[model samples]
Target: MTRMIFVNLPVTDLGASMAFYQALGFENNPTFTDETAACMVWSETISVMLLTHDKWRTFTSRPIPPATSSEVMLAISCESREAVDDMNEAAAANGGTADINPLQDLGFMYNRNLADPDGHVWEAMWMDMAAMPTDT
Candidate 1:
């Protein structure tokens, strides 16, 4: 069986977080959703667990870093360049903010960055398969 990945992120508001993801075309998985967290299904293999700050605190005794000051950024790839633009638009319409950087267009790839309500950065990228290297 193929391995699946679940990324857990902290959010200030569960409902708004869920709505933000939904705007990006992700659907909530009812099977693992509750008041504390919602399982957002991005694909068959990828899922994001949006956990409320209070719930996330239970996992660690140390203080949780605020999204604005997070050390790592999350990136998600789209099927096409148009999809990347669409996602960015959706994010803005759903309460997220677009990044300040200029758009990147390298012929073979296109990318844009956005920040969620809590300021977690997410990059939406699209890569051309034709430009990718193949195994020897």
Candidate 2:
């Protein structure tokens, strides 16, 4: 069986959250979408489930954290540095805050962070393994 990961997130507005994710290259999986939740697919093995506060409560009793608090930051790999830049630009243009963290460029690797409207942080990175530094 193929292993898969589903990241579940609690959102205040389901529709707006869906749109925010869609803007970041994730496609809506209608099979798992409904009024209170949406399944956004990033790749074959990865998906994000956006659930409304009420729907989220049904799964857990934990209190929802404020948008300023972060439990985790998700990261995705890009094909190149340009791709990373493009993703950041797209995020900024689509209601997300771009470059939330200091941009990093280590020659072999480049990274930028962005936050969704709901303040979920995501890192867009590109790395060139061949150019990675080696211990002398």
lDDT of 1: 0.87
What digit string (tens of lDDT, one per residue) describes model 2 on residues 14-124?
A: 898888888888999999999999999999999999999999999999998888988899999888899899889989998889999999999999999999888889999
**Model 1: residues >4 Å from true position, as ranges?**
132-136
The alpha-carbon lDDT assigned to residue 82 of candidate 1 equals 89
Query: Whose TM-score is greatest here?
Result: 2
* lDDT scores in order: 0.87, 0.92
**Model 2 poorest 10 in a row by lDDT:** 16-25
User: Each model's TM-score, in the order given?
Assistant: 0.91, 0.95
For model 2, which pairs clash? none
The TM-score measured for candidate 1 stands at: 0.91
